[model samples]
Target: MRITTVETFVLSERQLLVRLGTDEGLAGWGDATLEHRPGTVAAAIRELSGYLIGEDPLPVTAHWQRLTRGGFYRGGPVLGSAVAGLDQALWDLRGKWFRAPIHQLLGGPCRDRVRLYTHAGGPPGQTAAPERARAVVESGYTLVKASIAGPVGFLDSAATIARFVEDLEALRQAIGAGADFGIDLHGRVSVRHARRLADAAAHTRPAFFEEPLRPEHSRLIGQLAASTSVPIATGERLFCREEFVPVLEGGVAIVQPDPAHAGGITEVFRIATLAESYDAQLAPHCPLGPVALAACVQLDLAVPNFYAQEHVIDLSSAGSSDLAILRDPETLVARSGYLDRPTGPGLGIEVDEDAVRAAHRPDLLVPAGNPSWNYPDGGFAEW
Candidate 1:
């Protein structure tokens, strides 16, 4: 079937959806949302649609190569996100045409159910960290993660390090030893702070220390990995396999590539395979909408090295906005901390077009950008 139209909708300030319609009437959906840059990604999608208008939608890989490499300057988060949405749409079309799920098209399932992890322990300095951890564990999540919230200085005092360690220990104790807890530095800490925090939290044994150092300081990941026993996990910021090479070689135990911003299913699956060769695991980073989570679930089922899945929304919650946009809210809900294999075609979840369109707000098409912060001395601080 030839491509007929490529449409993008800014469903919310944080969610962007893409729908690719074909002459044969089969349409595929994808999420290309780039936090704080929805407008830029939407424009990128429109620009890339020029090459896809009359092309066949079944040749997913070929289309991916051209959409990504066709441009002289390629592979940043915006371009990767644009191509990622289109790639997901192409794969969805291929799946529908072949009458199979995307995972089956990728050589079938590796596991019966995909394990998922959710964020807990609200912003740092909250006294309810343990309570939040207990709440998620009681809800049937065996794994949970929380970020080192708020601004962090380059050389913060011992009190800063102690608070993080105390928080992690509390989460670990709250969940009991049977469950696992992870800490996300969110690229907000320097190498020195990361080292100190890792050393102090080693007793708690976090599932992984995510993005301890920013992407720019990735070369030092191996050195950092050598210093701590904790597993080093990163890659929500790194866009492609080329960018992942150093981290993989640096002994990063888990690679968390976001399908939405890391070339969708096509590239994330490849990234999982690349990580597999290095004896690492794939725990895809997905903190966006339902379509993006569905896309990540497909990869989790297909890749043998799949470790766990990260999600911002509580899939089991009935009132979550993430589920409101779907035709079947239960499509991605986890049972016993795992999502059963989806039997439906494509990404396996149906997007409620009416809900999506209704949720679209023109004013929200352009995000106001992420929050910024400053140190006590007035120096800029990472948010």
Candidate 2:
């Protein structure tokens, strides 16, 4: 069947959902939320819509190639993310047409379940980070992740480093030993400071050190990884497989390619295979909504080197109604820190058009969702 229309729903300030409708009345859903810039991603989806309107939705490979490189000026968060969502929708369409889950179509299940890790709370500096970590563990999550508490100078003092270690150590003590948790540097620390922080916290035994430095300085991560015992995880910013080469060669233990930003199932699956060659694990970065999480879960089920999946508990809670956009949200829910293999065809979740339509808030602008931060000396800081 040919695609009839392409629709975009700006569901709240952070979620931009895409719906590809077919003339035969079947529709596939994808999420293209690009954090603070949903409008730009939506426009990119519309720009790509003209080419997808009459095309067959089943040829996801051809569509992915064309939509990505078809512009000749491709690859970035906006375009890669736009292609990622559409690719996810097309895969959903393919699975439904074949009467099987997306994982079954991808290479079948390599594991029985997908493990998940939830964010402890807002940021680490928030008043109740340790308490929040305890609450998440109480809610049955065996894994939880939190960010480093405050901003750092180019070269922080020993006391600053001590506080960072103390904060994570406190959370570790609160959660106890049964749980595995990691501290995300969020690429906020400089290379020297990252090494210092990682060295200081190594005794705490984080599940993995995330984005020790920015993707731009990813090669340096290998130095930090080699120096510290904690596993190094990066790659939420790198858009393509080629971009992953240095990190893989640099000896990172975990590669956190975001399916929402790294070209969806088509590219993420390929990235997983590439990581496998280096013996690296994949813990996809999925801080978006349901459709994106469903897409990551499908990939996690199919891949052998899969690690834990990341989810934003607070965002999902705020947009709790967004779950109704799925025909069965239960399939995507976590149980005892693990998600059961999805059984439904096409991404294992169906989008409710009415719920999507009602949640559309094109006018809503939540600046608090993204805050601008600065150093004590008035220089820019990563937020």
Best by lDDT: 1
Taking the tens digit of each residue's C-alpha lDDT, what string does model 1 give over 87-160? 99888888998889999999999999998888785754542278878888887888988888668888778887
Q: Estimate each model's TM-score.
A: 0.97, 0.95
What is the lDDT of every predicted structure here?
Answer: 0.88, 0.84
- Tens digits of lDDT, candidate 2, 45-150: 9899987999999999999999999999999899999998899889988988888999999989999888888887545454128888898888788889987765
Off by over 4 Å in 1: 317-320
Model 1 residue 312 lDDT?
82
Candidate 1 matches the true fold with a TM-score of: 0.97
Clashing residue pairs in candidate 1 (N, C-alpha, C atoms within 3 angstroms) = none
How far residue 51's Cα lies from its native spot in candidate 2, in Å, is 2.1
lDDT of 1: 0.88
